[model samples]
Target: MAKYSLYINSDCSLIIEFEEEISLELSRFILGAKLAIEKASLEGFVEAVPAYNSLLLIFEPKAFQVERLLQETKELLDKTKSLAPSQSTRHDIPVCYHESLAPDLAYVANHAGIPTEELIKLHSQAEYPVYMLGFLPGFLYLGNLNKALHCPRRENPRPRVDAGSVAIGGDQTGVYPIASPGGWHIIGKTPISMLDSSRQNPAIAKPLDTIIFKPISLEEFNQYDH
Candidate 1:
């Protein structure tokens, strides 16, 4: 394992960056690092945010000296590398690709030079990795989208994208956990509630988890909606 680079991102945060590319190994390492750091309960630790290839640690400057924190962080990283990778949960989320649910399905298929059915087949067949959670409370930035389904964000973003909208932007795909302005091309909608305030863990999926899209009929989606 290569040494991860650690640097102070801000007065109260430290960034631990790994390889520049996105891959399962890098995602695992990032999540693992986060788990390790949290388990260590370093002085003044606030939280650990995991990304595709990096982990950000937020701490209180008043509790520990920056120099000492850096040394301790490095030692933690070295020890974490030897520990087993964290286990990841797989989530099967149902989605409806009906015209009403997927307003841009036809356009996306045309843009990809494939039939609508083929595009849906490709999208649903592959499993995606939850690289990070951002943009919204429960929004998951999933990766490993099929190359054929890769498409750029809309030239003009929609002012409001409905929550549970499954979208593809550039090389990634994600669900809009809340209604918000977005530039990604919406391809489907899931009936599942991705974020629930009442739950202990609000987000259904976490970093390094596997997400598989299971296609459902419009009627089935309607039942779920009700």
Candidate 2:
């Protein structure tokens, strides 16, 4: 069987799904395949959007040649290699895990059977890899949350979760770039703007980048804000 299978998503879209579960290696390969497809510049190609274990290819509907494109994609991925993680950048994000900002910190800590301080330490100790950004504007989907910190989303989602809220939902952790209704258990808040519309590149980080949360005091959070 083929490692990947392509399916028509729409008249203008095709999906390439890998026959594997989500993993760092799979993530790298997915990203690498995206870059390779972009470089191929196939006729009618529009963009290649990557996810944990799949890639979505869009094209000009009128110019789409299904058979030709499928063959081309298979050949491209076959010759393509996983992108080097060394080329990725490391982002040290400051997070204030104060009780005032972290409404669910104690809750998550309790669920994990660990003290709040220890929970923060465990959350900050590991480096998370950027998987993809979606489901919310500028929301970065980061992976590698510590198993101890893993907790289910809140039973009732907040009507409005403030931006910069660092949260853990299920097995993932990330910072909300904008205020929106959310169910992720908030454990902290960051002072930096993860998404700034004025900037040329609104998203602070991209796929293949690494992020590390540095715990900061509320006073330090105030300092960063000012």
Candidate 3:
């Protein structure tokens, strides 16, 4: 296990920073550290937010001494070596890649120098790791997109991108959890709802989860609406 830097961020939070690059190894460590910290049940521990290569530990200043918390956190981190990265849930999200839904399909295919069908195949074939969740309530920052399919975000941001819109920006890919303006290039639309405030767990996926995009016909997508 590599030594991670632990330091106070602002006045009430601690930041655990690992290697700067993004990799499965780093992600595993981050996840393990988060789980171990949660299990420790330290006082004033509000939540641990996992990112690609770090974990942000939020706590209440009044509930615990900072020095004591730091010592406890270091101890907990030492135990992370024994903690295996938790088994991540794989979600086969259904996406409609048809022309009507995938407005940028042609553009993306042209940019990749491949046929639209081939682009869809490459996009849907790989199982992406959920690196982090950000930008929106259920927006999943998925990683490891095919090199051939890598593309930059649109020069002009869309005024509004519909919910369930699967998009790619730079080397990362993600889904829009709600209708909002975005710069990512939309490749398809998933029928499955990724976020719902009414549900206990609003987001269907979380950090370290595996997401598999399954291409579905327009008819199949319509079935989800009923």
For each candidate in turn, the TM-score is 0.94, 0.95, 0.94
- Model 2, range 45-159, lDDT digits (tens) per residue? 9989888888999999999999999899889988878888897899999999999999999999999999999999999999999988788878788988898888988999999
**Residue 148, candidate 2: alpha-carbon lDDT:** 84
- Per-residue alpha-carbon lDDT of candidate 3 for residues 139-202, written as tens digits (9 for 90 to 100): 8889889999999889999999999999988888888989999999999999888998988768
Query: What is the model-wide C-alpha lDDT for candidate 1?
Result: 0.86
lDDT of candidates 1 onward, in order: 0.86, 0.90, 0.87
The TM-score, computed over Cα atoms with residue i paired to residue i, of candidate 1 is 0.94
Model 2, residue 104: displacement in angstroms? 0.9
> Candidate 1 residues 1-226, lDDT tens each?
5457998898888999885677777776676677788999898999998876778899987774688889988987787753233567899999999989998999999999999999899999998878789889999988889999999999999999999999999988889988899999999999998999998779998777889999999999999843
When summed lDDT is taken over every stretch of 10 residues in candidate 3, the lowest stretch is 79-88
All candidates: CA RMSD (Å): 1.6, 1.7, 1.5
Residue 138 CA error for candidate 2 (Å)? Answer: 1.7
Displacement of residue 197 (Cα, Å) in model 3 is 2.5
Residue pairs with backbone atoms closer than 3 Å in model 1 (clashes) = none
